[model samples]
Target: MVQKRISEAKEGKAEEPNLLQKILSMTVQERKDFWDKQFMKCIKCYGCIDVCPVKREEPEELSLSKWIEKAKVPPPYPAFHLLRAYQVWDTCILCGECEETCPAGIPLKTLQDITQFFSPEDVFELVPGLDKEIKDVILRFVDSKRTQFRRVTYGL
Candidate 1:
């Protein structure tokens, strides 16, 4: 079945709705509301994290895992989900087990599908205000570099 899907994808015969396309079609406010609703449904079960097969294995000194406070209900908005989402981006195999185990039926598979639409840098956009801040920082960096290049090339 997996091979058949791959062959169908290569032949452009796959009829499934593209997850990235669905997400991109939404307005910014819609995207925010979508994620907010999806994440708020989490019951702090940690099933998603538990089912992750390639969780970060870094030793203590090099560990960068954002520790989730399991005791809190709803797990403080996106923090809990964000950490898990980022961790699974490169590792998720699309097995759907996490979604199956989630008692609240939070679509772990669909949430993880955001990786297809976003790179790590743009992932911050899922949180309000962070997207604008990231854009500003990138613009400032680009402008500063352009100014430096002009000064060097044209002796401005």
Candidate 2:
């Protein structure tokens, strides 16, 4: 599925979209409605963030995992998951820890997968917890704000 998504992304197809691409094209209301179902199960325990091995253990409140608030009993819709998706998308190695740690049985791995579908093929090797150096470089490049960003590599 990942390979197919990458292939379709590279091709820039506009015809009938697959399930992964469908998520990207969903309207604001449609997206909110869709995620509402999934997030309703979340208890805001932050277990998904805690179990994420790809994230840096930073004490700073704005750091990746710390961006999620501790006070919200129920997480704020899909925002938590969306933020987490960007945090780990390029580096996730398909580990199921986040989903496993979720007491609510939310499919966190699947959510991450959907987000990673658009990650740059060069940056996202799906290599597991062993690519910290490469992940850091990618994050640094993004934070530097060198260009209009989208993971898809066009003629830029």
Candidate 3:
């Protein structure tokens, strides 16, 4: 069933609209409505963030509550939340720790895995072996951003 869902998602044939696009397209009301439903299970235990290996790389100010708060404030651009969502692709190891720890029983790992499919860099990371061509591609992708930003931003 998981494989089937993944295959359908890859084919853009999932019954629900693409979550990445939907998140990118959300209005204020829509964003709030959507997150409220998803977060209803959240107990504010901070288990997800706590277990996330990449939390150290995330901005100190970015928190689940902050994301929910952002959802309530505006439309057209969910810049902070969207950026944070994208960052999940860079940090997640598909470890499933967050899912297991979630007191609310949210499928956090599944959400993260599905979200990764929408990130080209994350897709590249899933390639089977490291070869010269793959190395070149990864370096080029990394180098492009190095030139684009001044500070040291290691993760995507």
The most accurate candidate by lDDT is: 2
Q: Each candidate: how many clashes?
A: 0, 0, 0
In candidate 3, where is summed lDDT lowest over 10 consecutive residues? 73-82
Per-prediction TM-score to the true structure, in the order listed: 0.59, 0.53, 0.42
- Stretches of candidate 3 above 4 Å error? 1-37, 60-85, 119-156
Model 1 stretches astray by more than 4 angstroms: 1-20, 56-67, 126-156
What candidate 2 gets wrong by more than 4 Å, as runs, is 1-30, 58-69, 119-156
lDDT of 3: 0.49
Better of 1 and 3 by lDDT: 1
lDDT of 1: 0.56
For model 3, residues 45-102, the per-residue Cα lDDT tens digits are 6576677777666543333343344334331222222333444544567887877987
Candidate 1 on 1-156: residue-level lDDT in tens?
A: 544655565567887635444455456787778778877787776776676666665323212233445477776555556555544444567777877889888777766665434443444564433334434443343345447633212100
Checking candidate 1 for backbone clashes, the offending pairs are: none
Name the candidate that leads on TM-score.
1
CA lDDT, every model vs. true structure: 0.56, 0.57, 0.49
